[model samples]
Target chain A: MKATNLSTPKFCSALQILGLALMVFWFAAPVLQAAETLKLSARLVWGTNRDKSADDELKAMTPKLKSKFVNIFKWKEYYEISKKTFQFPKHEGKQIRMSKNCEIIMKLLDKDTLQVQVIGEDQLQRTVKHPLKPILTDGDLFVVGGDDKDSYGDAWFLVITHPNLGKEHKKEE
Target chain B: MNEKLVIQIQAYLDGELSAEARLQLLARLEKDSEARELCDSLKAEQSLLKDVGEKDHELPVAHSYFWKAISDEILPHPSPRNQTRHKQTAGAFQRWSAWLVPGGVIACIALVVFQKGLLDDVLDGIKSTGKKAARRAPSFHEIDSQQQNAGFISFRSESEGVSVVWISNY
Candidate 1:
């Protein structure tokens, strides 16, 4: 007996539908994921050689987070001056005040790209644009910091990250 | 009797000879008794064979079954060339069908990786443009400092997977 013919209309229709579905998924996956507003955590951290901050309201940084800062900078201890978690739509910017002296304006330039403007003492200090997907997906840190004007020897950091990035990374593992 | 003459007589009886040849052979047969006798025997044998062939013979199985068996044997045994052509067609179909899904998947993955800038990072790492470039693993599209007193330095630590942008106060 002859084998079944695949050139028939039924078979061709099925293949066409399958191809259309895959193409839709290819384009739609990123759009669907990017459609939701981005949730981010911005922290104002004080990095100093002193073991503790003079202000009692400041909280000590998490051990896992402190280890990351310790490995990169010369700071002996890290204290969180303020931390804010917020969500903003794509291609738009949001202003978050982490502390009285430090605030940051974050803009989602694209799905995985972000532009950050750091304002310290009501002055625009720096503007940086970086890809946020790799950092967030990989559970990495994006830190913007400089020497403190009030305290000459100490430095301050504006640490931005995805709040759920670590949990997602752990799930992946 | 000569074998050649017997063959000629058979041809003459079968009407296979041309008109001239037929007349010549007929004249020889009239004169030759041996040729006449051989021709008669050959004609009688042909008639008997024809009768036997025309006689109805019953098959052990039904007629349809008998014919079907022969068709089954002959139909399944296709010519070697046709079989090769069929195999080639099937092989091509299988190859295309097999690769369709995987090829689509690979294309999707490549697109996603490219869109995510992972491919660029990999390429940059491979090129290792400079000392600073090699260390700058963070995929930054742009960076600017608004104040003259403040400047920014950015680098990535591959070991910790961390990107640091240090805003230095000069």
Candidate 2:
């Protein structure tokens, strides 16, 4: 056989292979899925382009939950002082409630460097200090955060950590 | 009176003078009219600090009875200093550090966010942002009875500089 004999796959053979591939894809799907323990679900949106308006771009990214990050900060120097203190607005955002043994963690993309993990016990008791970078983990989901390494850079992420179970209170005798 | 001598009289008024120093100062005070005036001025400052304390002793109470009752019940039993410290790690400044436990966390996280470059500026910025609940699932494998299974998943950040692993439990 000449080297040129292997050109395009034969149409009948390709059709047979395509059918097999689809079957394989479907079969491998769930087993592959079981391997995933965490899901970071969110969207990014952008407003108009240089030529387009910011409003127009955001509208295009509609409903996806993602957006172009607008960083307008530029100054001669970083915060001139150390020990600067700032307060964040408390979030009364949706309280993601779940059954016992299920924790919900929400990381804020703009507010913090450390992920905040709050355990969701029955009454929110019990302090377990494992020192695992304050990550929130459930049997099914995980949420974590890290800080920007650039010196005095303004990137931040807020990670919310919650335990699956609440601390049990000691009953009074 | 000389300024130095006036200062000496001020120290004497505060009871910071020794016996010989007091005797010497007293002699000068008796001889100099200006020394006597300086002593009167020093006495006024001492009297002022004392009066300030008396005034502070009468501040209005801040807590109402009802609020106190709620606080007593809600706040956990903070054991005595000795017993409380017996449980936590020990150091001379441990007590003071306790006050910082909550506030320290707030700062560490806030600083990291600022450091991570999560904030990219316009034009030369990441066009999109948001976590992709990466929907890739695994293929199922036939297992023998009572056999354990294991698998791994990998992920990368937008910069692609950092990667993480999600390991399955079984």
- A3, model 1: CA deviation in Å? 27
Cα lDDT tens digits, model 2, B1-170, are: 46789678778877899999999989988999977987887788888888777333666666676676776687667569855675454443445454555455555455444444344322223442422322212112111112234343444333221222322321
lDDT tens string, model 2, A44-158? 1112223333553212221111111222212211111111112222232222333233233332422222222333343331111121212222211121222223323232221
For model 2, what is the error of residue A68's alpha carbon versus the real structure, in angstroms, after optimal superposition? 64
> Roughly what TM-score does model 1 have, to 2 decimal places?
0.52
Identify the leading candidate in terms of TM-score. 1
Q: Which 10 residues in a row give candidate 1 chain B its minimum summed lDDT?
A: B132-141
Each prediction's RMSD to truth:
12.6, 35.0
Tens-digit lDDT track of model 1 for B1-170 = 77888788878878899999899998998999888888898999998988787557985898878877876776657789987988888778767867776776687688778756688778867887765446545656366876666566778777776788876772
**Stretches of model 2 off by over 4 angstroms after superposition:** A1-173, B52-68, B71-170
What CAPRI-style quality would you assign to candidate 2? incorrect
TM-score of chain A of each: 0.74, 0.24
